[model samples]
Target chain A: MTPDQILTPILDWLDLAGVAVFALTGALVAARLNQTFVTMAFFALVTGVGGGTVRDLLIGAPVFWMQDPWVASVCFGVALIAWFTPQRWWEGDGIEYADAAGLAAYAVLGSAKAFAFGVALVPAAVMGVVTGCVGGIIRDLVAGRPSIIMRPELYVTAAAFGATLCVIGLSLRIEQTVVWSVAALAGFTLRAAAIRFGWA
Target chain B: MTPDQILTPILDWLDLAGVAVFALTGALVAARLNQTFVTMAFFALVTGVGGGTVRDLLIGAPVFWMQDPWVASVCFGVALIAWFTPQRWWEGDGIEYADAAGLAAYAVLGSAKAFAFGVALVPAAVMGVVTGCVGGIIRDLVAGRPSIIMRPELYVTAAAFGATLCVIGLSLRIEQTVVWSVAALAGFTLRAAAIRFGWA
Candidate 1:
């Protein structure tokens, strides 16, 4: 099998995993605001797919969620979970760590997809950052809160680092698995440290 | 010339007109909030292109702004205009009237594009509404204000009227110019009336 054939399934699974976690955060935010279930679902759907949609558009690919029923189902399932769970169940650094995992995985996935679509490396890295951050921006906007971008968190930068590393590793013909794993780990480390230390 | 060839330039022109107005509103909002020039430009670019960007993504078209420099230039120009103008210059119903005009034109343009792309009629109309209103939604979100969609107004309804009418007319094989003009007129009238009467 070609390298692409081998990598595609793994990337697809990673994409869905990232979507589920991001959708959870979106629904959790809506629950915190006491929004209705409909709102929660909308938040989940948009947050889960928003970044990928933008990435696909920029790369001239079909929007991913529209092509796959599974993506939307994952978002809806996660939304239901967040809606049914007690808010206290999600309180702590655990959710933040999960979000960091999603961010790093998504950043790598976004860059990899862009490169597969023949995007230049730099723009692909930028697409990675966009994919990781845009969903939260949309969620905050809909929820009428100050967006995460407005905060001085190291969120976007972490995604950028992961994406850039992935792009560089791929360009150097590194093993795909090792490149992705290391890149995601680097991003997660930065984010986890930020959360633990309350870094601006 | 083919029908598409004949229509492309006209539609492009209308798209730019819509972008200019939406960008102006975005920049004006930033100005009202006393934001810097950079914020004004960011707001203008995002608001001006946000709706059409969504439409293009959903339909699998190349993102419009990235393919055309004129769109971004117009957005920047409008932002500069808003930034330099005195606050009083944009006061009263004039900007509202301009926004109404843009809403009508963009709604028709968005629906027409969707139809041309072979989207189903109902989804095409919905695309029109999305194209006309999403820019302001993003602008409001970035500015940390309640979006127009949440307000008690005829805003989205007006865009829907124009989009639905355009789709129905095209489906019935009406002349393109007449269909678009009539649809835009209907939307403008509704929005204008809403602005004048403060309709919810």
Candidate 2:
């Protein structure tokens, strides 16, 4: 199969999974703030799709969410769930681990997309980091918290590592699965360590 | 001259003026926060270009600042100026009036740019307001202040009025200068009134 044919389903599933996790985090922030359902939905949509929107725009592609009605529907669903559920259910380390997973997937996906769009490697790596972190940054800003990027953390650095690995793999013509898995694993490992050990 | 030819230089001047003033405000916010010169420059560049970057991305235009080196240079210049200036110099209402001018100009410019990109009238008008307000929103978020949008003021309303006027004039095929001047004046007048009289 052509590389596009082989990778399409894999990337699609990764994108949806990443978006769903990010949307949940956004809704949780709204719940923590005691905001209305409308605010929760708004936050979910923005946080889920904000990074990809920035990446696509910077790469001169159409905004991805605009083309997919399902993206908004999923955000709405996440908002509803958060509104109905107890906040305590989502209050522990589980959300942080899930967010790390989403971050890694998004960073890899963003780098791949930028590369596919003919961007240079450095900027593509930057796009990857942006796609992973911008959503959380927007979430924090709207929720009136200090930006995650401003805090001494491994978050952006983990994303950068993932993006750079993806770019390098692609440039070296490595097999797609190995490339994606390794990059995402590296990012997730670093982020999880940061969360678990309270690493600055 | 063709319309593009006629408006290019005029719009260019307005764009530079708006960006410079917004950059100054961003740098001032950094200074107020006791941030370093690097942080001040980063804030200035983001605030100076944030709104137009959003508008361009949403409208599928190339991101504006990336194409122009001078934009970053101007932001750097403004940051240096802010870093050197005393806090007392920027206190009180002078910066407020300058911000008002930038807001009006950005609103008009954003509306015109969106219209030129063939966005529908309502969305174009919305883009105008987004362009005018988003920079300040970003600056506030970075500075840890409540967003100006959350305040009870005529700020966004003034931008809406300007954008609406610009859209109407464009639909009527009015002279470019007339459309731009009237729309900007309407926005500036409202904002100035709000600042002077504490209008809600």
Candidate 3:
């Protein structure tokens, strides 16, 4: 298969998965805050798509969510789920694992897309880190909490590692599927380790 | 004179003035935090261009700072000034008055640009408010402070009123210069009054 044929389906799935996971987190924040349903949905939408939106704008691409009909619907659906469910239902390591997976996928996707947009290698990697972390940062900001960036966490570092790897792999003309898979898995492993060991 | 002819020059000046004032505020925030020069410069650039950047991205216009040569330079210069000056140099109501004026001008400019981009009336007005307020919102977020939006202040309200007036006037086919001037003056007056009387 051509690189496009291999990467397209994977990227599409990654994009949706990332948005859904982030949206759930956003809605959970609002629910914890005792905000209205509207607020929950708004938070879901912003957090779900915030990073991708920033990446697209920076790379001068048409905004991904604006063009994709399903993204907003997914965010709304996630918000509804969060609203109807108790907060305790989501209390566990499950959400963190999902978020870690999403983060890695998003980092890989962001770097790949940026490289395709003709961004320089370093910036493409930066875009990857941004795509992974900015949504959470924005969520904290709008929710009036300290940004995750201010915390001594391995979150951004894991994303940066994945993004840099993706950029490097692509620059080396590696097989697209292998590069993406390896980059994402490596990042997810790092994040999972961080979570399991309570790494700062 | 053509609407474009009259409005362009005014908008240009407004854009620069708004950017400079906001940049100063951003740099000042960093200075107070005792951050490094790089952080202050980053804060200044983001605050100076944050609102306009969002507006442009939403409206599918080219990101203004990326296109303009002078904007980054101006932000750097403002950061440098803040770096060298005493905190008390920015004390009192002088910066507040300047910020108020900048807020009004930015509101008018944002709405006009959004309308010109063919966004509908209400959203165009929202774009105005976004343009005037988002920079500070971002600054506060990055600085780990409660957003000014959470405060019971007249700040956003004044911007909204001005944006609404600009949109209404443009829709009514009033003279462009008159619409812009009246809109900006009305907003500035509200903000100034709020500052003077400590209006919540």
For model 1, name the residue pairs that clash: A152-A200, B152-B200, B153-B200
TM-score between predicted and true chain B, model 1: 0.96
Q: Taking the tens digit of each residue's C-alpha lDDT, what string does model 1 give over A1-200?
A: 64357656887798899999899899999898999998999999899888888787787866777867799999999889888889999989898999999999999999888777766665667678778888988888778788776566778778878998998999899988899999999989998898999986
Tens digits of lDDT, candidate 2, A1-200: 64346556677678788888999999988888889999999999989998988887787766777867788898899889889889999989999999999999999999988777667776677678879988988899878798775566778788988998999999899987899899999999999999999987
lDDT of 3 at A30: 81
Docking class of 3: incorrect
Give the per-residue lDDT digits (tens) of candidate 2, residues B1-200: 54446556776678788999999999888787766665676578778878887887788766665445466678879989898889899899999999999999999999998888789999999999989999889888767888899999999999999999999999899997899999999999999999999999
Clashes of each: 3, 0, 0
Alpha carbon lDDT of each predicted model = 0.86, 0.85, 0.87
Candidate 3, residues A74-121: lDDT per residue as tens digits? 887999999998899998999999999989999999999898888999
Better of 1 and 3 by TM-score: 1
TM-score ranking, best first = 2, 1, 3
Q: Which lDDT tens digits does candidate 1 get at residues B18-119? A: 999999888888787766665676678778989998998887566676546488678878888888879899988898999999999999999998898889
- Listed per prediction, chain B TM-scores read 0.96, 0.95, 0.95
Cα misplacement distance, residue B148 of candidate 3 (Å): 4.2
RMSD values, in order shown: 6.2, 6.1, 6.7
Cα error, residue A35 of model 2, in Å, equals: 10
Candidate 2, B35: how far from true, in Å? 7.0
Better of 1 and 2 by DockQ: 1
Which portions of model 3 miss their true places by more than 4 Å?
A: A1-13, A36-39, A69-73, A142-144, B1-50, B62-129, B142-145, B148-200
lDDT accuracy of residue B50 in candidate 2: 83
